[model samples]
Target: MSPRKILGWLRAYAAHDDPLVATANLVALVVASNVPFYPVYHLLLIGRDAWPALLEAPVALIFFAIPWVSRRSGLVGRTLPPLVGVANTLFCMKILGEASGNALFLVPCVVAAAFSFRAKERWVMLPLVWLPVAVFLLSIDRMGAPLAPFTDAQFAAMLRLNAVSTGIFVGFLGMLYGRAGIESARASR
Candidate 1:
């Protein structure tokens, strides 16, 4: 297919109001966000420990593959959302373990789940995305010091900042989706 056609296909795929599409879009967003960070982490004098940031690309690729494989194997409708939710939670834990202060990554998955899954499914996913992180944060002392290079104050600040930013992002996405739903409903009527 031509590049334009391929791009159009991807756009349509992502625009679908389905759980699988949300999962794919979330993975794609992570990959897109990570790719540009590589150069900045390497060239800029930000910090030496930013190397782990590069792992997000491959991780997202792996997560992206899950939905594709499950779809091919006829498991998309029954299983994809929960699987993506678990994977997202694991990734959040990995970030926490790495002391990356990027736990905010969970927010997008939760937000996407809101758009994609039924209310019951979202209830399941919401805890999966948050509970582990809450436990990890609470047991930080038991887990020993963070491996990230940041000092205690810096780490705390980063976590707080991530939380605030994630809240804003979730609010924005909620408004945007709510508006779209209203518009579509009106159009249908």
Candidate 2:
């Protein structure tokens, strides 16, 4: 498709009354946006492991393709982002370890789940919301130990990087969900 056509479709796809679908689409777009910067991040950060950091590019592509996938499967579209998010975070934690502060990303993953599901889906969303917490709690000791151990300087820098990045990601999610709330309120009128 032409660039204009693709953009139009993405905009239309993102417009949905279901909070899960809408939020997932936005999250996918935002996550996919980071694929291009993976190389830069690998060079400047993650000095030892170029491949693990770049592995995220494929995940980002998966997020980017979610809209297309969801067109055929609404359930998958609505649920895939958080499921994949938790899994991805876990993978990063295993490789990057607790020192990178990667676990902080789990907070937004749960928060988004809470907001994404409506009354009917609350039960279904509950397990997802806690999955990250459960896994992290069980593996807390391991997550803190860097796989290969970063130097003191690297540890401090990774912590700062993850902290700032998580903050920005959390804020992005808040804005998307917050906008949805406003729309919902206006619709009730």
Candidate 3:
């Protein structure tokens, strides 16, 4: 799209209006999912390998917290998408190496894609949710890898979990965004 359109979207996102807040929340969810890694760091009590996930949680939490703080402070709700965009890339990389991490990490991306649609047509973003999920599945199959480690049962469970998580998140975003859109429109009048 044109820069003007992109800027318009960015302006809307930063405005503390409905969709923007919801978008921020989605970004928070993405970071929140990573929160588990912190406990795992202590649980495993490992050294360097665990550090990335360990450090990522708090940073993600801060990103998640910003929108709420900004709302109270009357600051614009900007910063979430860019943060989420970066986080998504990181999560995608993690997924490449870690099979179990895929389901949780996909949450934010799915939510963000949902919010990107006009509230009335948010369902159109459902397919975007499937994209990461499909890649994750294909990854488990080791389609490009030297070998696949998961059994059929494990793969089935992963698919089931992916489907359920995607459904729940997509539904959640749709309802949240849909309500926010209606409320915003009403407030404007």
Candidate 4:
């Protein structure tokens, strides 16, 4: 399908779906986009212990499922993405170690959650936000030895890659939410 057609389809899809579904789709796309890069990430490690990176494929599929599942449950749609993100990042960080920088993704999880819900849903939003922070806090002192034997230079590269990627995701989120805020204000006028 053409890029225009695909985007038009997404625009139409966003129009009909509950607002939560849009966030779910965004989360899905982010995860799915990284799937192809997993091999490259493994290559950076000189091809050692590629299995942890392999786990992201199923996680992406799981993320993609959120929008479909949201048709039936808003709670699931809003809750699953960050929860799964926290779980996946924690799992990857544990095996890849802190130096691999998988832990940085938890920030995006918090940002995604913050944008996914409204103030009216503060009770629900509270847990979604806290889960990532909680996971980070609990794991801070517990991260184990690197399972892949990535050299110090490899670790530094991984940290830089993840940090830059996280910044980009957050910037993307700002653009999305910022435009959304403008649209909402215009609608209310």
Candidate 5:
């Protein structure tokens, strides 16, 4: 392509609505999804010796490639990273199945997507809010356990706490990253 065309493409890709905020939220999503899945898969799939080495490759591809690509071409690199990451997470969740840990990698997506909101984009968090609830309820039903057992209320409480705690964590993360996104947008202009 001509130099002018290349430059135009570069601007489009690296041009985030707010780079720092968007990038931070993206990084957080990458962490949230990869963190829980990594150990769970390691324990369930690769045993003690192999998963560590295998894990770094995709993680590197997702995060490192951002600045690397931006520095090199400045095109669609930043713009596309989040979608690529999400697609990869979905694949991982599917391949790992129950061993993926948590459900379907929904938590991280919800959290990251929340930070993407502008005033016009506020609707994004709605589906995100519902995902975990759906996952938890579905899990409970599929597991065929009572929501709370009277004699062993502690186990039920633990389950309830885990769900609530995770929800709160994701919400807090959404708020923090969302604020960062707003600041980044202001700074960009």
Candidate 6:
């Protein structure tokens, strides 16, 4: 194919409006977010301890592949949303387990799920917001001072606050998006 045709095809692929695309984009954002830290980690020679950050790349690739697989497997509408949600939730838990302060990353994951999945699929996003809190609560003793750079109480409070705030923020955005979508549908009709 010509370069122009390839570009046009790529644009159409990206604009396909599939939930898998949204999920993949969110995962891509997560991968991008890690880019800046890599240089610092390497400069500080802490890259060896930063192995978890390396996992995001492959995860992002898998997320990017999901849309194509779903397109062929007929899983886009039925299975993909929940699968993405669960994967995101697990990813959040892994990050939280590795570093407590990184809990903030869960918010965007939840928000992405909100934007990707329909209202009826909102349940998928809920655990993405809450699982980190549960992990934090369960691992409180091991998360203080040397390991976490915060007191146990402070870390707990921060984790709880982040989870609650993210939930509310994503919920509000979801409602706003839902209303806008409804209005757009009505206008179209």
Indicate whether candidate 1 or candidate 6 has the larger lDDT: 1
What ranges in model 3 sit over 4 Å off? Answer: 1-19, 26-63, 68-86, 89-93, 96-149
Q: Point out the higher-scoring one by TM-score: 1 or 6.
A: 1
lDDT of every predicted structure (CA atoms): 0.49, 0.73, 0.50, 0.73, 0.47, 0.46
Sequence-dependent TM-score of model 4: 0.83
Tens-digit lDDT string for candidate 5 (33-151):
45455445444433443233244345644654464455453334433344444554444333333332334345655555555444554454455545545654555424432222223
Model 1, 22-98: lDDT tens digits are 44454444444444554244324335544444444454455445444544542243244334544644554454343
Count clashing residue pairs per candidate: 0, 1, 0, 0, 4, 0
lDDT of 1: 0.49
Question: What is the C-alpha lDDT profile of model 6 across 142-165, one tens digit per residue?
Answer: 543332133455445435644664
Model 5 CA deviation exceeding 4 Å by range: 1-22, 25-41, 44-56, 68-82, 102-104, 120-172, 175-178, 181-189
Which of the two, 2 or 6, has more TM-score?
A: 2
Off by over 4 Å in 4: 1-17, 44-51, 184-189
What ranges in model 1 sit over 4 Å off?
1-6, 15-45, 66-100, 119-143, 152-168, 179-189
Models 1 onward score TM values of 0.55, 0.83, 0.46, 0.83, 0.44, 0.47
Candidate 6 Cα deviation (angstroms), residue 38: 5.7
lDDT tens digits by residue: candidate 4, 1-189: 999998787555434244445655665666766756765776665465545566556666777666666667776777787888888889779777887888999998998788777678899888899889999889986988866677787777778778888899888877776655565557558
Whole-model lDDT for model 3 versus the true structure? 0.50
Per-residue lDDT for 14 in model 3?
Answer: 43
> What's the lDDT for candidate 4?
0.73
How many pairs of residues in model 5 come into backbone collision? 4
Give the Å shift of residue 183 in candidate 2.
2.0
User: Candidate 3 residues 55-159, lDDT tens each?
Assistant: 344555565565566576421333344334445444533532344344454654555555555545445455655555665565554523212244445434444
Measured with C-alpha atoms, the lDDT of residue 80 in candidate 6 is 43
Which pairs of residues collide in candidate 2? Answer: 98-143
